[model samples]
Target: MWLKVIKFIAGILAIPLMAAVTRAFYGNIVGVVELAGILKYFMWGVGAYIVLHLLFFKPMFIYVLGHEAVHAVTSWVMGGKINSFKVSDKGGSVSTTKTNAVVELSPYFIPIYAIILMAVYFVVAYSYKINGAVFIFLIGFTLTLHLVMTIEVMKIRQPDLMKSGYLFSIVIVYVLNIIIIAMLFSLLFPSFSSKKFFADSYVFSRDIYAVIIRQMFF
Candidate 1:
């Protein structure tokens, strides 16, 4: 009963949360014309993957592989032992000694391929300038792959959301994705400010929720 109420409230809160995050994200990226080249490559990467998606070339096995890997990795990071891992064309699964909201939902938010790519980029970037558009293109592609797969997966009933409570899981996944995206933008653009992105998110959240509360009660 209490859990149901909490989930219900969580679903309602997602509305303001989305609005605040969108504002914060837009505030950070809007009118930052200096890094237009980088943004272009990134967008090109996004569009490229989207085109592939339209053509039905998006690979389900790859996403399923990454999805299970993220679950296994997050489990390990949290001191949980992986029991078994499996991935097929239809879907994937991972068993861990421990399970939590983060473990169950990590695959939805963490683009494992893009994260691996970024890690490699940082290491290689330490010695050599990765100036080619190919890097950004790959980033865009993998992230979109993650996004598209996640959206498709989300449409069905997920045991993950059920374990965490669907409303709570939905809000958590969305907010974390927004934060992750803002952080990625900060990494890609020299002039983009992560601190400012967070600050804007905070300000928007505070103001919007305040108005919402006022209208509901006062």
Candidate 2:
């Protein structure tokens, strides 16, 4: 928890550093134009992203499954039993012996790791003018997964963590942002089912994390 607080502080401190880098790399106006293009890509990227997740990316499903598995396994390892685990096309959950800090956190961290891996891939894809299609794939996949996983992480049950008022408030604000973004995505792309999209991603993270934590700890 203290580590996370420090990370949060470091992230806040990095804003100015990022701003300086942006100014250095591309003067303000140019930076703005570049940023605009990236933003525009998001809509097209959204379609590409959904299609990839819905079809091409079996690894993403495995990662999500591992995430939930971590949560369930961790709970059991910490002396709790999983009463039920229900998986579906949309989403699923595991009713456990009980919730613990470590167990609850499993889902959150697995997605963070997955996000980092995706970030690395995105950086590499963009760095080299690799195929435009590849860049599109990386961008779409990473953005959609990152956004949805963030929603799930913030949604997890964590009363102990919430007892720290600061963390509790932060969670509320973060989840609200996730909700707003998801709504915006839904409005922009009416073809996808917002509820199913969010729920599936959420469950995937939790179960995959559960399995990971269970393996690591046990």
lDDT of 2 by residue, 64-135 (tens): 565567778888888898898766535557789878555655554343433454456558766765554444
Q: How displaced is residue 107 in candidate 1, in Å?
A: 0.8
Top model number, TM-score: 1
Residues 1-218, model 1: lDDT tens digits: 78767877877777688888888888778856655667787888888888988886768899999989999999999999999999998998998998887899999998889888998998999999887688888988888988988888887958887777777777888888888877876887766788988888889999998998899999
TM-score of each: 0.93, 0.33
Candidate closest to the true structure, highest lDDT: 1
Lowest summed lDDT window (length 10), candidate 1: 31-40
lDDT of candidate 2 vs native? 0.52
Record all residue pairs in model 1 with backbone atoms less than 3 Å apart, i.e. clashing: none
Residue 2 alpha-carbon offset, candidate 2, angstroms: 22
